[model samples]
Target chain A: MTDAYSSSRLVAGVRTGQQRSIARMISRIELGAPGVDLELAELYGSAGRAHVVGVTGAPGSGKSSLVSALAASLRRDGKLVGILAVDPSSPFSGGALLGDRIRMSDHSGDGGVYIRSMATRGALGGLARATTDAITVLDAAGMELVLVETVGVGQAEVDIVRTAHTTLVVSIPGTGDEIQTIKAGVLEIADIHVVNKADRDGANRIIRDLTGMLRLGPPTPPGEWRAPVLGTVATEGRGIDALAAALHEHYAFLAAGDGLEQRERAMASARVSAIAQNLVAERLTDSGLGDRAAQILDEVYHRTLDPFSAATALVRVTT
Target chain B: MTDAYSSSRLVAGVRTGQQRSIARMISRIELGAPGVDLELAELYGSAGRAHVVGVTGAPGSGKSSLVSALAASLRRDGKLVGILAVDPSSPFSGGALLGDRIRMSDHSGDGGVYIRSMATRGALGGLARATTDAITVLDAAGMELVLVETVGVGQAEVDIVRTAHTTLVVSIPGTGDEIQTIKAGVLEIADIHVVNKADRDGANRIIRDLTGMLRLGPPTPPGEWRAPVLGTVATEGRGIDALAAALHEHYAFLAAGDGLEQRERAMASARVSAIAQNLVAERLTDSGLGDRAAQILDEVYHRTLDPFSAATALVRVTT
Candidate 1:
């Protein structure tokens, strides 16, 4: 197939939400393949429709299960949903690991639900860049909602999760690190707090802790959204309805105010800045300045030039 | 109080290992304060002497205590040691949070020991840059050994920890997420695996698990160093000697071959690249391109242009 003809076909397939086309495009994006940017730019014109919701928490927080349940609930509401399971920690686990695929079995054979997994592509902003790109593909693919799920509250994960219009932070009882999580600044970004596995011991304590913290948290201004703490038994499908309702209410709240537009603008600014930085970094590391970078880095290694000065020199030459 | 005069005094104090000057310089570096670069450049000349060791693990793994124990052991060896405890998660926890200060009470008034804590500065690469800079300050301050401690095995933590010449990955008994840590690529970077709180049940199990996993891990050629899993009750200082021995042995092994030079070169490349990226990000966000970035970002928000294209435009203008 000619390059032009193949690209056009892939674009058409993505427009019609063909799974194969979506997967292929995402693979190319994840690999940082050439010509993908042109295709992504085409898809970007069709995006801005999907309500992106991010789910993140510590490992063993049942994030995957809660996401599955949430997908099932959203599917019940007759909404087209796309699930992006991102594992920034694991390079070995690629798109749709076995566990994630098994979870997708719950919605197997359903046209409304599309599930995919993404792992680390490169160091430093690579995963986030690819994630935003993949979300665009899914958004353009006509999914009404895109759920981005990640398993840790690290800085990288937080940055990824913040791309969502509404973010759900999943927690569970008996983790014994609840206070640390709150202290880690995860509370600030959580549009809704979920205490999963509510049947387990200390579930009420977790709920109570979250409630008390939120109450004591900075007072919500009048007519502004206050994050709610909800309990869930994701495995058994209990409380999934309430969670889904909260998700909708949050989205509605954002829509009712300038919150959605503000979020869009902020996300745009961040994404653009990240892409620009990545472009510059790639130029310095892999392109025209590759040799220069190696020489400058050697100077830094030998202590002949400080890293900051070396970087300044590298940037000067590149710019 | 002139800038030049004060800068020289600070440099001199750092060279002589003055605690106040070291603390002030690190604070300035952490805040990305102006003119800290010149001073850091001077100090960078004196670095590459300290045997930097990094200790990292999941929260509640007794990382802090183990670090404290290791510091004590190193100090007892008549070596000047600097401890930098980094918490990337908490924005509220600034330098020297209460718990960490108390942990340092163990070495209170010990002129040979200096400890500092660092928190998030800004999003994306901020902590890592600040960290590398602070390590320079510590390394140049006549410390024979510098231990960089961070909680969690997230990408951010992993990045910071990898800057060390010898990296110690801490684990504990019964975290129930041990396998996940290995799966997250922590095992690959670990030169020595220390299971803290070894008095707890399942310590043997974790040690066994780590050993078996290591054996099954990629083949280790003859004379290549294999990561050792050791047990330690950090609070009681039990097995501290063994841990210290492992650390020293690893250092000797690195010093014996091209490993030290290779690691240094790799770290230098990473640091310089990160610094260059941060510099570009700052310029785009704060300097000449600030207005242009805003305008381009607005276009992205309106979906008139894709983020990738907007980024390309921004970089084009900046360059």
Candidate 2:
């Protein structure tokens, strides 16, 4: 854990192309502290280069397997790839959780592909705060593409997934209930839909249902820019080449950009958000205002004042 | 829409229990500009009386219907309730969408029950920034109890929901196939488990499954309380009375002596987080470094400099 404190140095070394330093640096960033904002800002320069693809769906949907296959295919094409497998944190005791990465141990030795696991520390919905920072680290490390595989932890929006250059929403067969159960937030974010584990009995039906549902929502496009539906039996490494092709085509399409302003806007937004988070953390921890705020809240709880006043009081004490 | 703003003002007027100026004063406070923060701070005295209950679940798990039923039940008990239903925002156009509030129209005439529908404006997982402030307004308005309902917009950490004194997670039957879909963050925050629409065939089985799973998780007792599980057919209004009783009991149980300390600690923590957020936001917006950031990021993209040095330049520019 001490490694996390000096992680900025590791991140720096990694950005300069030190392999071991990059590997260690990523773990530090993934630890998710208030301090990572600075490191992330540092990495911002090298980011926005990689064709980032986010893969997410229900847990145990064989997402990691799909990611593994996809990364292998990308590597075969002589492209350096980075893979992020976000695992669920133990709600009971928050710690290093990697139940999703058990399958990826087989492919660990593949030099061209680097895989890392992330924990959320009981955060609701999507990947932990540090995953993006780690991705930025990987992006700076010169990976041609990055694949972020996450178990959909009951999230509706999956915004983190959507922030990537392209997003793949992978669902398996026999999700008849979830098809109706999940909200529109995740669906709207999808650029490419993958029905993984296609070897199952209801694979064809799931694909059909997904296709029908997708059409009901929005018009995909005029000619070829529409979100495509793909099928893959990921565990057996089937249909991976097609998935890889779809990823490349999406990248090329994005490369032929309509507007760079929107992309720049998104990047600037992330930068601003990161800055805000860092400032707040610093104030709360380093400043004695935290104690005074607690005292005011305690007084309010006793019916002497209110929280709105208490919040205002915090501003005064700090100033 | 104007009514809500006026209603918000009316709330602020009543918060200080100054019923004479309540209507006109509330109108001033409801404008939702930066100035309202000051008025809310002034009314902060009456806010602590309310025990906030946050109700959340996967989308289409009938959260809106359940909240409606719960509010109706509370109204029958002669309790003045404030309801905030948070729904997903449209990706194309951002607006404070009210699409999910149709079920809540029944209480339109009931001045005691204020129902506000909020839209998630794609702020880091589709939540609007003003949500917490709006909730605080409801609290200060002299409403005895506030219910916050969300559509699982994926914001990590969920510190917003953590502010609620109690959180109920509603699930339905036939959710077994999608059982892995339950989020760890939401599940952990549960103070009470509600199986709404229990009239379905698999109701008892869902109960059993919940019990079975809760056992695996082994109730560790959050903040000296063990979350209870209950069943309800919210549409039929069954089990609501018991749910209400349990909630009141929990509220009373929470307010008795030692419980205040716990609640105080939670609020204190929130204040720190709030203070931190404000500081960061102010710095980022006021720095006037947007152009420089864009320029340096452009340079880094072209490989003129590494991200590490680019970030330092950005910091130097801003600072």
Candidate 3:
């Protein structure tokens, strides 16, 4: 069975919407198994096409319901959608237990849609990389819309969701963290804010807090690109329309090419630099430049060398 | 200058109420420079000494002020205190730009106390290993008490504070995330539940929510071992003494040999694993076995081989 899952077959199957093939393809990419790159490269071209919406917030914020409703809305508009629900690995198993997948299980029978879960098994930065590749794979699979739902953000949330076309930073009332969330780097990247469960007490306060803080940030064109903080009760399926409308409004704003160019620019810079770091580091290690590498590593340990220096030297080894 | 920072010097300076040397010594250890380890080992004999207290909660729950007041209370009791504030680094700059540091900056001139801020840089895992090492340095520096305040009970908070003799999870009136916090892995580790800013509107409601949730969790004895939920207005210095007293009471309970042994065991296990991983990774990168790594990297990227396979192949080469 595993042999049947050679890189070529996996890629072919994944392209045709075969679950097993997509799963196998993800494993190959994760493991960096052979032929996955060819599949990924083919995927790369077909990507840059999906309306990738990223959903992230403090947990219990009803992000999954929001994604579900948004997908349903897009489906109503006659577009196929793909959902990637990212879950944290149980430290013991290092695999997504898919506990959160239960929230979106209602869409399992939707033929026009796909949902996949990925885990970070202490891969550090690898989770974000896998997510980007998976989005590409889904794009190549011909999905017109993609929604990414993160289990929760820890220190790595910014790195993971920075790829989305329009990223929503969801927040719940009562977290008393309106300022802290902004400080945590979530506020800077959010194109929309979903004050989820806004029917609850203090919901309006959260919105007001976000507005006040957003004003203090680097000059984002006021009103031209105001992140409409919408109130939503995802569990009861109320206010999802407003959320969807807010998203589309954001989409149209990005379609102006300027907005998208900036998003594309950010993602491109991240991708190029990340791959370069890993690849160059590997090459330097291969060329028996042990002493040179060790010195840099020691300096990094000593705070005398930043990661950029080590990464740059690794890249410069060829030059 | 770094040489004037060992135990004797710090203790001597500390006797004269010199705060700068104490801060510098902790920073030196937190950076984990090459020579810091031996100094740490020399100082280790004096550690296992402090009734280390851990303060953690949501980002805006005012953990810093709570810690500051707690430290102040301890200082009033003539106890030498050390405070370690763990703030998230700005990815833009690799420094701990602690916005909350202002809450505790008033103590900068106090000689019977020390405060140092640590940031999470590129280190993998939750707490930076350097932060862990710095705590050990402070413990050895003859401080009678140490308050280790981490931003939140994200993975890093749990990892860093789990070894504390007493761990307080600070929460505000409304973080509606009481359940989510448990799910995210903070509840299970909290030694005390502190509902800070009791003057806030939702204080009692959160307490009710927390109390109910605590009932649903595995029942622990209502003795000193069970975590108690307390409330305070840390900014106004209300309930600080009570909180400090609770901390000392918890510390005394844990100071009995059982808690001491458990803490030591965890520390030893952490040290061994950390050292083992570092050494093995180094050995693998050295020994001119670099190309096996390169070949493996190439294979992973080509999607012909998975990362696990490459890692295994590289490990075999090390052998």
> What's the i-RMS of each model?
3.5, 7.4, 11.8
Q: lDDT by residue for model 2 over A182-272, one digit each (tens)?
A: 4434656677988888988899988887788877976755644678889998878899999999988887886677533355455444444
Tell me the tens digit of each residue's lDDT in model 3 across A194-276. 88888889998888988887777677665468777778887777788777777778888887758776676546534533443
Better of 1 and 2 by lDDT: 1
DockQ: which candidate is best? 1
First chain TM-score, candidate 1: 0.93
The true-versus-predicted C-alpha distance at residue A29 of model 2, in Å, is: 2.6
Ranking by TM-score: 1, 2, 3
Interface RMSD for candidate 2 relative to the native interface:
7.4
**Which ten residues in a row are the worst by lDDT in model 2 chain B?**
B310-319
Q: Taking the tens digit of each residue's C-alpha lDDT, what string does model 2 give over B1-319?
A: 2355764665556665453444344334333444555555555545566788878766556777778888899989898887876654233333344445476567777777777665544244323334555556667666778888876523432455666888787788885522532544457677888888788889889878777777788666656666778899877888988999888977877777477567656664565455435443443342534666556545544545544344344331110
How would the docking of model 3 be graded? Answer: incorrect
If both were scored by TM-score, which would come out higher, candidate 1 or candidate 3? 1
In the predicted model 2, the residue pairs found to clash are A280-B276, A306-B44, B9-B26, B9-B27, B10-B26
lDDT value for candidate 3? 0.64
DockQ agreement of candidate 1 with the native complex: 0.47
The candidate with the higher TM-score, 2 or 3, is: 2
Write model 3 residue lDDT over B1-319, tens digit each, in one string.
Answer: 4454554565455334446655665666555545555455545444667778878777678888788888888889999888878754232233565654675566767777777777655433324456666666677667888888886555456656765777888878766555445545566667788989999999999888777878887787554487778889988889899888888777777766477556655454344334333333333332423554545444444444443334434431110
